[model samples]
Target: MKLTRLITFACLLFWLTPVAGQSLKSGAANNDEIIYHIFQRSFYDSNGDYHGDLNGIRQKLDYMQQLGVTSILLTPLYESAFYHNYFAADFEKIDPKYGTMADYLKLIREIHRRGMKFYMDMETQYVTEDSRWWKKAFGNTQSPYSDYILWDDKENKKPSTIVFNLTGLRGYDGVTRKITTANLNSEASKAYNLKLFSYWIDPNADGKFDDGVDGFRLDHMMDDLDNKGRLPHLFQTFWNPLLAKLRTINPKIKIVAEQANWFSLGNEYLQNAGVDGVFGLRLCFAIRSFDKKLLLANADSTLAMLPPGKQQVVFIENHDVPRFSYGVKGDLTKLKVGAAFNLLMGGIPAIYYGQELGMTGTSANFGATDANEIPDRQAFEWYKSDTGKGMALWYKQTGPWKDQFNDDKPNDGISLEEERNDPNSLWNYYRQMIAIRKANPAFVSGSYKTVNNDQEHVFSFIRKSAGQTILVAINLWDKEAEVVINAGGNAVNIIGDVRPVLKEGKLVVRLPPFGVGAWELK
Candidate 1:
């Protein structure tokens, strides 16, 4: 047992297809959008430089389709000195390391061609000194973009470290210089952002809408714009107005905000910021930890805060935190439980690129540079074979945690090459669960109702829509248990090896540790 390994949609029966006025379809919720979020530099490399690019992602569309993903979320593609690309050097061009603007445009066209949604992540809150506005307007009162950037003093040239304030903090070496915050309220800033944002939604200028991205992920989204939460003028003056303008240009273009301090504070952004979706970080943690009570309470409380018509993005892991697999110490059974919860949960289910492969990484000590968090964004392990073709260890010798990410670790239960065909692997578990969800529409656009089961180790719920319902039962234990979950339905379809016999209208089954099953009710 030595090392290494690893490892949609339809529409319209007069259903939620894009209409003439709406560029994005609603009503389907996130279940209809199985999002695959990728950090480009760590994905697949097509250029042989060991750096992944837009072309690399385009090359893997078929692989994504095979895995049942209908949407893809890419980290910010704008030119940047930072590896994460959240702080942009230029909002208009694709980073040369990624490829040309031509290549990016081509990728977008292909993604939409395959009936998939493409979402590009952007911060729009900060920019590097290399930005055109920063270069021209810093300490220059006469320049048109002078107010576009925030300076510590009207006469000072150095940009304020902004909200997160990394200027003086000491850590890794990448950010030797400071990144300035954008004065979001300034007409010049909004005007510039609007232009950049507009171009991505309808890149061809034809207004066909199909050729460009379907949405944008607003990174570090907030209502006040600062940690103090005192500058509460932006949502009313900045975001709402800007989003309204964008909607006028392309009504279906979706906007999702990564609410500032998302795990604890997101409802305000969703309720007042006018964004289409916000990340449900609290719920994500609940599922990952297998806290049944907390998971239910948090989900119900958070969902109640959102006004009807708004949705939250639910995921087990993203680029920001440690991988779920690592959180559970790479125990494959727990990994399967986490996967089932994420994919089958309510709201939009986003899959971090290598999450399905049970990839494990941690970056708890982030500092001056992305190098501090590099381990979490390690290259996708394409195979245990060739050391290079798919092993995109772009930050190998540079990051602080490089040694911690050696893919050769024994019993990793990771790597796409290792898990692609293994029936019991985490990769296949995701595929099977996704298939079950897709076949049952209720799981996608249904109402979530918590089912009370007397057994303490079993957690249950029903996803119901119209006349159909599917009860999902999960065993959050480490040992097999024979239990009866009081789901008022007969099993029409069963998943995994565990089968629950119906007795007195209750589901009775002996489930292995961390087992999951779904029943289509009569």
Candidate 2:
């Protein structure tokens, strides 16, 4: 596809321009500001056991520091039989597959030493059958937690009988019965019933539970998995206050909830519930929209939906979801556009481990075969190091992706190492955006307004905080788009060299396809 450009004012005016009275912020402004995501144990592994460990993460301090990341949110590192650690067997100990308590503390120290924060993903629901609590709850008698977990067993006679067949859920690997709701309140349930608040913060759990990780990402926050209310009092009633107790151990911790489908009920519950932030599902969709109008529409809608004083965890890709490559079907141009949005737009941005470099996967049923499920789970092809073979390999060697290699066709000819060195690479684009966000508080904590523009394909917004103002504009169409910024103020373009001069109270901007521009009030 050819890019539309307009030549005016004696300069090549490509898509993307800046306007005035807008606020912007980037990593350069705050040394202690960052948002990070933890994924499957494939980022770094010293044992070569095909699983990433806490110590392996310790080895990559320089890489994270280079990105100017100030916080890390790890996936379920606490012990569990499941690969994702969403099924909790032991809430206190780090999974043996990942590492030990010493390794976890070392990783924490490493992150804190660099002036960063740490958090983990948590499953507030069931535990693995092997959990001591489950075993102790239901002895030899046939109980709902019989094999070890007590569901709300509504169907069975004894109430102890488990019920299965939950729709839209990827069932766990186990024996032959389904767990229903009737068993939850059964006589057998009383012994092993795990309350959401009591599990993770067990002060006396030196023996079985007690993984000393800081913070938590309430996994599947919007799901009614146990037949609870849509929002569930489990979190609002119990977990929120429980976090306060956990905070006694470390006061500076942070918590982000993974309420992926929260848009259905609105975000008030999450924001008002005292979480630091919730996943930005709407923003993720905005990045995926190749159409400029759709992009702006989604972006505007999301900004409108968010309650004041609350934050969204904006990310291009996450472990549980398909990557941008899958969404764009390996289209590099669209992928770049998505990355631009993730970095430039409002909210705390997070990048999945492999998203920086292009990785590919789809929603095909992997069946019992784990090899070909999602692209995000695929191993790092180190030989195709342009996109980041060494880092990818490091992650693969340390993670579950070790067995799947992409040797024949490396998705993109750029690696983390290669892009970091190239000034115009996506890696640097991200750096520039982060720098802009850090430099302007308006971008970080400012209120936003959609700039009215005559062009349908151009997206423009002003971010203002305190006395600072920054303008952000993007071209969604392949054709050149002319936009008029109505806000008052002479602004400097921070993303690139393209700048707009205000004349007669209007700043006109021309943007090329998939282009991004940022303007800061001078």
Candidate 3:
């Protein structure tokens, strides 16, 4: 039974209903968006093929919208030999394991029809041996595609390695495959990537972005590719020019870059590379540390680095990093605290899929293979028993790789089925926090300022805009504490468990262990 477009639309209509009296209002600006980042391969399985596909995502639209995210960001969907889809074999073709091109178009259309944005991840700096460039050019000096890939020898037999000078990577299927760096210096390669990016932005070429992705997540974006100095000044030579042409196609297209140097604030990328956003990697580490001073310093520095119209994509976890729940050791209160900071800290919040459900995973030291990331990118647990329809456990029976898998615990209150119905669950806490963020404009597009507090254990900040002011405070300690913030006025508790009162020209609130509070100053 093929899932027809009509049937899919019917399902969309059914799930699009507002859940639990919460509905996302349409026509919100991009700056006000909450992005839900998904590693689609482990999200949901719709065809019972054990692999998550475009159709699987279509079936879960209601779940995403109900969670209050305004946009969706997916990892690369191009055909690749690797499970994570970074080493592209073909830039133009959709991975056959995921679905057909029709499935992708339908998914994009439905996503736009619901007033949500979609972002595609692209890593065109490298390619696998299976790519057409490598096949036609390797060892063929006379081949026209010779310049398309960087070669270490005149015969073109030895292709340049990516990142750590590694020529090969082990895929999730336990097969080791060789990879080569794409020659970004070649004019042909740059032109090809420009065309590839333009194709996804408007597949039909009619200038209507209804069936195309709203933007792209430039993976591992760096001026000096791999930091080897081989591809220096790529921002001027490759990216800036390519991106300039893309905006001509869609003026509103957004591009976010994953800066290679995580320690740097990425101000250069925003100021020069023409990117709209960059991951706040420093801020993420601070939030995970549960230290008030670290969080305050990083948060201030991160926001200060952004250009006028650019944004800092704040998050606690992504496909490459360990889960926040794992870092907090599965403490529910700490998970809620993480959620509050992720939503109310006055930046573009991106919630990794399953983060709200308290999913736990950590990167393993599995030699030089890409399988080390498998644990962090496990299947999304939909059922409490870890067995049911739409469970995309593709790596379940795959030998040693599955041995490293520690996520998706069955009947452990970590699955969506277990958390969705419990009001006190981390999932519900995320939902409520998102609702609060959407209701307050200050938390969305306002200026972030650190609020001085008497206690060192409480991290306090204020998000201010015209006619709106929101003060957010989080208790970083494991014991209940009372803190006095340096702001006092008529205010009301808008979110969290505690109410703050004014005394001695200060706002005083009692916070429980790992507690959070948001108050709207009048």
Give the best candidate by lDDT. Answer: 3
**Considering every candidate listed, which one attains the maximal TM-score?**
3
Question: What lDDT does candidate 3 reach at residue 129?
Answer: 90
lDDT of 2 at 465: 73
State the C-alpha lDDT per candidate. 0.75, 0.56, 0.84
Could you estimate the TM-score for every candidate?
A: 0.90, 0.77, 0.93
lDDT of 3 by residue, 464-487 (tens): 777788888888989998999999
Model 2 residue 486 distance off true place after TM-score fit, in angstroms: 2.7
Writing each residue's lDDT as its tens digit, candidate 2 over 1-522 gives: 000111221121121122233233221121125566756465666566656667767777777777667678777776765555655566667788777766776677677666676766766354444666455544444444453344334332222221123311232232212222222223343333334333443334562223434556776553333334322454545455555665665564566776634333225545555676677665565556555554554555455345554566678777655667777765555666777677656677787766765666543343432233334555433334323322323323323443444432543554564556677666666666667677778776666667776677777787767777888887776666667877667878777567887878888777766677788876
Candidate 1: what lDDT? 0.75
Q: Candidate 1 — which pairs collide?
A: 3-410, 5-414, 6-414, 6-415, 7-357, 7-414, 7-415, 23-252, 24-252, 30-348
Better of 1 and 2 by TM-score: 1
Error of 1 at 95 (Å): 0.8
Prediction 2 TM-score vs. true = 0.77
